[model samples]
Target chain A: MTFTINAEISQFQGKLYKLSHESTSTKTPMDVNVFVPPSSNSKIPVLVYLSGLTCTPNNATEKSFLQYFATKYGFAVVFPDTSPRGAKIEGEDDSWDFGTGAGFYVDATTDPWSKNYNMYSYVHDELPKALAKEFLQLDFENISITGHSMGGFGALSGFLKNPGKYRSVSAFAPISNPSTCQWGEKNFTNYLGNNKEDWYKYDPTHLIADYKHENQPKILIHQGSKDGFYYKDHQLQPEIFVKAAEESGYKGGVDLRVAEGYDHSYFFISSFIEDHAKHHAKYLGLIE
Target chain B: MTFTINAEISQFQGKLYKLSHESTSTKTPMDVNVFVPPSSNSKIPVLVYLSGLTCTPNNATEKSFLQYFATKYGFAVVFPDTSPRGAKIEGEDDSWDFGTGAGFYVDATTDPWSKNYNMYSYVHDELPKALAKEFLQLDFENISITGHSMGGFGALSGFLKNPGKYRSVSAFAPISNPSTCQWGEKNFTNYLGNNKEDWYKYDPTHLIADYKHENQPKILIHQGSKDGFYYKDHQLQPEIFVKAAEESGYKGGVDLRVAEGYDHSYFFISSFIEDHAKHHAKYLGLIE
Candidate 1:
């Protein structure tokens, strides 16, 4: 994990830094942006944000609605690019919903992609190592993950499969049952081989279908009723996951909020970002 | 006037529409975004927002910190592009600080640009005509103008010269004395041709020096002390205008606020946009 600090600026008493690194998981170069709260007296909780398709690290880190709440609550934020760059590997820059900008946050096992597309390991393993060593003297025990759209899938799959890694988890219109959704089905077949069992490890409902957490961390989910993808084979059908959690005795740590007349747009996110920030702040004990 | 709607979306209980039309003054086509409040009952106060150089109606309408405040206060907002487009005129789009997006809100009188670069007339006359015909129910009598950077120059110049057009005027780091600034000097020389007297109509400081308003509307200005251009050769020097106003026994209708350690960026504007919006709201009696 060799890294270098690209740039740093003081904002609202906190310091935001741009970082670049050479990763072993992705086997390519990557860029990330981080914001550390001014309260340096103690270790702070961390939140990793994953952006949706056709987005780079800049989208969430630059235009995100999380910084205000993060600054107030004294939590740190880590934003990594969706996929590796400069490699120009086969089919990296293909479709808007797949390839380069859309890594789907999964470790690619298929040929041509498996070479440099391993976002799961980059985010789960390499990213934590770099952030923990370089940025904050933060409590790794209280870190959480949250995201939107494809990033939402990343949050659910990342935290559910690696339960002990993240203390809590939440998402803004995530892909709950990816195996059944068009986006999930396409990416899964390409990244995780044809075996159905391999796909279960990355689906939140499947991971929680037979497991129960005695001390389950709080989980929050927001879905937009007017989202275009809700109909047909979309990833966000909260009922499936809710029934699974109930039948499996998942201990009721989940909160699902549906916003009416909202679409898949930044306007929708900005409207309720304050609420999401407050949710993370309260759970992290950064604010009352 | 023939008119067409570009893009529209429902928001804040009203409709926001982007409109386009051919202009009599500017000759070239012009585009503007107008947001009508949630009421069809009575005409509401209008707030015209002029954007800076290198900006179109799109920048302020999409990215500015005004929409939330306008929605909260129940006021209409109209944003006009800084200059005429598709002129195919020479010397346009030459510099970052001048031409194309930098109309300086003045009707050109010289060269190939003189034919289609009449921004002053387009904004003050043609734009108003289109608005009256299209938005017949809007309260034109309670109109106010506010802007930033070059558009600030436009706001101050337009309101002061027109006398009774706007009930209130304000700016965010406007180029106050454009006649004495490099940006103004160069553009005026090219657009108006060596006639200093003709340039007076387009300079806010010059207008204030010659005219006095007994019941002048309140003018508010927010400038960042750390702004790189404040003290530079071509800058909006607030102290000079303050001295002139004091000498003229002007009852301080203009309020100048200098924020410490801030720069000339959207961050600074977003920090204090609510205050400006409230100021206009107070004058319009939209909110108590």
Candidate 2:
């Protein structure tokens, strides 16, 4: 891994590393921020955070209190960029929700996008291994995953696609049933190319019923009741995903929490970040 | 206070109100963010935070964890802009420091700047009264002040000049002796019109010596040892401020803590914000 350290910043009782590296998956330089807490006797657990649409690694790395909680829980956090930046595609910088800053965490099988939009392989497979090699004190096997909005969809899809890969998973106002949302449809049609089956494979709502695990771990999710994306535009259909989870063999696995008076912003994320951190901490065995 | 609520976002158990109002002090539409915690029997004490140069209310409001501490301590936090924005004078938006964001918290006496650069009066006087009217539950009498860098200078100058106005005061990497530093000298010269005597009035180190107070409250301050502004450029002369406080009979009143390995950013501020908030909470009788 040809990794370059952009800047190392201190926050809470930890150091946040702004890093970029050449990726084999996407064949482009990727930026990822990793925060490691003060060392302990045991190797620190890792929690990979995927950011929402129109966000970069710096958004969650700077705006949210993830570092504080990671330090408190004695864990490390990895903030990956929303998409492959500076890819130089023809119309990549057009829409806020589609091309730039919205990879949607799917391996694009379609033309043009297939070259640089391999975020699924980059995030789920390559990034973790690269981070582990750099930070020997990090326990990659005890890693968990979480995200917000578009990143939330990435987290849920990533967790379901590869069962037992992550110790646990959680999301904050994720696009639960993206197969049914307009935001998902535009990206899926262009990235996956007309195959509803290909979209179903990446959709958490549809994939939940097909995914098989011997011991189904509880999936924690927080959906804001006042989220405009969930209520007005219907961009997030968490209820449909919850119902699908119940219909699947993994009964009572999805723990959906509807938070009142919250929105789809970092304010909502920071508010319940303590709960999300604690949830991952329990599975990672950082807390009793 | 003709206040217009721009946006109200929820964080922790409180709502962060992004407000812009026609200012009686700056004579421009001023922006400020107020986060009021969940109400209790006791009226909430206010913590007015002054931001550094090149910052608006959103920089500190969105980046820092002041809202979390405020909710935890049951107090309200007011984040006022560094200066009156959109003044549109010649060279107002030229440099990142001198004119636009770097108000230096001084009531300007020079041409062009004097019309709108009245942050000293805006933050110290009119802001409090205006905020008090808008937020009825806030206990203005028990309010304390805090800031980062330039705002740090503001907190100290305001506290010293006004004497019994604020219950307590603290700073993070403040430009202590602004009459000496480059950032201070440039702003002071242009804003105060080459009048060294007038500049001393706004300089915290100089004001500490002449101001007469019945009881000197301990002013808490944290200066990062690794801060380039402090170590290399000598922009923040905290040690000079401490020595002046002692000579002026405020012995042991200025608690100057030089924190190791920290920088002059929100990273440093967020790490020690709990301590600053607690310091004010103690004076406000929130904790024993």
Candidate 3:
């Protein structure tokens, strides 16, 4: 469970560490970035940011500006890789949206991917426990999760599935209804197989409505109105998930905002990441 | 010249334009990124960011938080390429520090490079004039200049040479005393035909003392203590420039800040970029 420190970069008023460690969930070496803000006495709260398809941990760490506000509000941000690299499975690197960078954060029950593509358990279980063992300054109990695109769907699905695990969750242009969209159907059919039951468990639109928890989970979502993937390709269906959350005992808990002229790029994430940071800050008890 | 619009991405309620145009100075197809902040009534002020060695316009455009502050302060940001690309001269792509990406922002008097490497004229005169001709909403008269590493030296030299051209000047880990440094000696000898006198004209440490302007040039510079390139290699001689500036009647104008635990990466640049942005914004009349 010992993680290797690849590089430690000083950012904002804190330190960003790039770590590589063997994972139990995925059965492969995983790379992750953790940024700890400058705090003197108290243990820092945590924020987990999952990236979209064709992205590693470096994407959000460099461009998202999450660390900027994290340093301001006092929290540690953990950026986990999208998928296990160097898996070397056939057709793994075939499609940009299907395999390789696109793990879809699902524990595959299907073929060759099943051996190494357990990003769901890796992100939620192994990674968190391993990180807790390494960083003593981090308070895992006061952690919030947020991500963009596929990772956004991952955040919502993870939040809904594991009630009380995360303090709060938010997303930027997440694939809300994955079971129906082009990206979702392709990924779910391939990763989870033909079983619609397994797909339903990982889908935010389905999970939010079918949540077994008595307490409704709160969520924050930002959708770029000018996003091509969302509008033209219909890749991101944030409206579907928002409606589901509203109908399923979460009428006022979901904060879905549509930013005009903004796209699905990190520019959109960096623009409104301050709002998401503040939202988590309130939940993590960093500010009153 | 009629510039080809490569990309126009929406960021922070503004637009980042990726433009390509044939440069008159360099005689090559040059690429530059211009960021325009959301403006309603008045024309926007501009900041020309010169990037370090082995960098295109993309490095600063992606990593540096210049745009974050540019959007906040209601100022435009122009990111110019380091050197002319695909200039198939002999040994042009051989060395990382000499040819290709490392133009050192100098107008070369030497043979092969003399034909294409005229970054001095390109950055100081041509780019601004071209940008002004293209962007009608930008107030070119209110433009300031700034850069990092080699680009820092370029910024200081450019600011010093063209008196009253730029409203303000700043740098992040600039090669202040380039004539004395290894990087400067190699570049100057190669580009300026071994003339030490020509080297002095471009050296910030030399130029600050010999500046002909009656009005003292105020400058802001940030240096990282942990930067091995600065401390170990002695590439950035900021203290030497500071001494020269003080001795030559620009006593209180030079603000050289040394940040602790910071490195030479954009992490260091993004950390204190807000201060630089505020400095330029004040001179640009965006804030009181």
**Using DockQ as the measure, which candidate wins?**
2
Clashing residue pairs found in predicted model 1: none
- Give the CAPRI rating of model 1: acceptable
CA RMSD per model (angstroms):
3.4, 1.4, 1.4
Compared with the true structure, all predictions reach lDDT values of: 0.78, 0.89, 0.90
lDDT of 2 by residue, A146-187 (tens): 999999999999998998898888999999888788999999
- Regions of candidate 3 where Cα sits further than 4 Å from its true position: A212-217
The 10-residue segment with the lowest total lDDT in model 3 chain A: A210-219
lDDT of 3: 0.90
Q: Which ranges in model 2 have alpha carbons more than 4 Å from their true place?
A: A249-252
lDDT of 2 at A167: 85
TM-score of each: 0.87, 0.98, 0.98
Tens digit of per-residue lDDT, candidate 1, span B171-284: 998888877878889889888989899998888877777656664766899888778789555477866766665666666457999887656766556556777889888877
DockQ of 2: 0.81
lDDT of 2 by residue, B136-225 (tens): 888898889999999999999999889888989999999999999899999999899887999999899999998687747889999998
